[model samples]
Target: MTASFEGLSTSAALELLSVGELTPTGRLTEASNATLYCTVAAPGGAEAGCVYKPVAGERPLWDFPEGTLAGRELSAFAVSDALGWDVVPPTVHRDGPFGEGMVQLWIDGDTGVDLVDLARDTRHAGLRRMAVLDAVINNSDRKVGHLLPTPSGHLYGCDHGVSFAEDYKLRTVLWQWQGEPLTGEALEGLAQLEERLRDPDSPVAAELRRHLTGPEGYAVLRRVRLLLHHRVHPYPSPDWPAVPWPPV
Candidate 1:
């Protein structure tokens, strides 16, 4: 088994992913999208395993534009970084084994953590952050399987291609904090996201604007503002499914 990546910050991982030579190791057969496991080799012989989702391999969805799923993955990471929550793993969009696609540092988390149980627990700090993130991006699918717990207990989420629609479509299994007030950390994270999005010169905004439509970016900022104004967790949409199918 590939070992957990160690001693690398998010920036370092992104740099390696952007410039590394990607070698396909295997395909993740369970995913509906064309997902592959790749080995990234740096010029100096440093190596890491990563998940690659090439645009060419994306299954067409009627709702999302063709060839945009990879970009959404990058955008999701951008928002996560801007929030300083570090919920999503380090991800980048670049040329891959199949073609240009999304490449993310593989999180080799501990196999024993029950993410479903964590999502169910109202007081779990990590899940609270993730829930807030889902609300900001209007995540359409926050399946329990997307949440991974590291051996050191840090939480990471993956497969964010279905997020950030211009419309309200937040479907998730993280309703444990429903009707509760936003914690201080959650409020602070929303503030950071709002500030970054409002600055046209911000690198985070620039990167996300490149990937998401103008309305989509605006929707994210609007959601943050609404959350800050409400001071409570937003209620699940009555018009859309509250939870993803095959939730786990």
Candidate 2:
């Protein structure tokens, strides 16, 4: 298995994903969208595995009428980067062989840990941070299958194409922390997110605006603020389904 690429700084990983020559190693057939497993080599330098998802390859979903799933992927990464949560991997919106798309650093997930068991394992700090992250991103799909647990104990997630919607729609299998008091780390992350997003010209806000609608961009700030105000894990929204279909 390839290294999870966790050692690289976020900037270095972003650079590789942005300018590295992408060569498709294989296709992720299990993915709903066109997901290509690729190797990206930087100019005369570093190389790593990544996943490429082209925007044109996305099919219309009834609830998520907004186009540009690739952009949303980058947008999700922006928030995660700002929070320093590492919930999402280093991702970028760039042109690929299939056209403009999202490229994310590949993570070699440790498959020995059963996801169903992991989902209910609230004692894990990474899972808790993810719950707070899903709340901030307004993630509408956070299935157990999306979790990527590395052997080094870093947890990453994928398939964030349906995130950062203007409306309240957070579906996930991470409800174990519901109504629990926010941990110090989670509070710090949320504080950082709120501070970064409040500035319109901040890199995080700018990236969000580039990908999401004006209202959606504002909604991101609102979500962060709500989390800070509550100072507790969010409960499932009554208006939407509490969890994702095919949960695992």
Give the Cα lDDT of each candidate.
0.86, 0.88
TM-score of each: 0.96, 0.95
- After superposing candidate 2, which stretches have Cα over 4 Å from the reference? 1-7
lDDT of 2 by residue, 59-121 (tens): 888867765888989898888888887889889988999999999988889978888899899
Q: Global CA lDDT of candidate 1, please?
A: 0.86
Candidate 1 vs. true structure, TM-score = 0.96
Give the lDDT of residue 110 in candidate 1.
79
lDDT tens digits by residue: candidate 1, 13-90: 888899999999899999999999999989987789999999899888887763388889988888888888888888
Candidate 2 is scored at a TM of 0.95
What is the model-wide C-alpha lDDT for candidate 2? 0.88
Worst 10-residue stretch by lDDT in candidate 1? 1-10
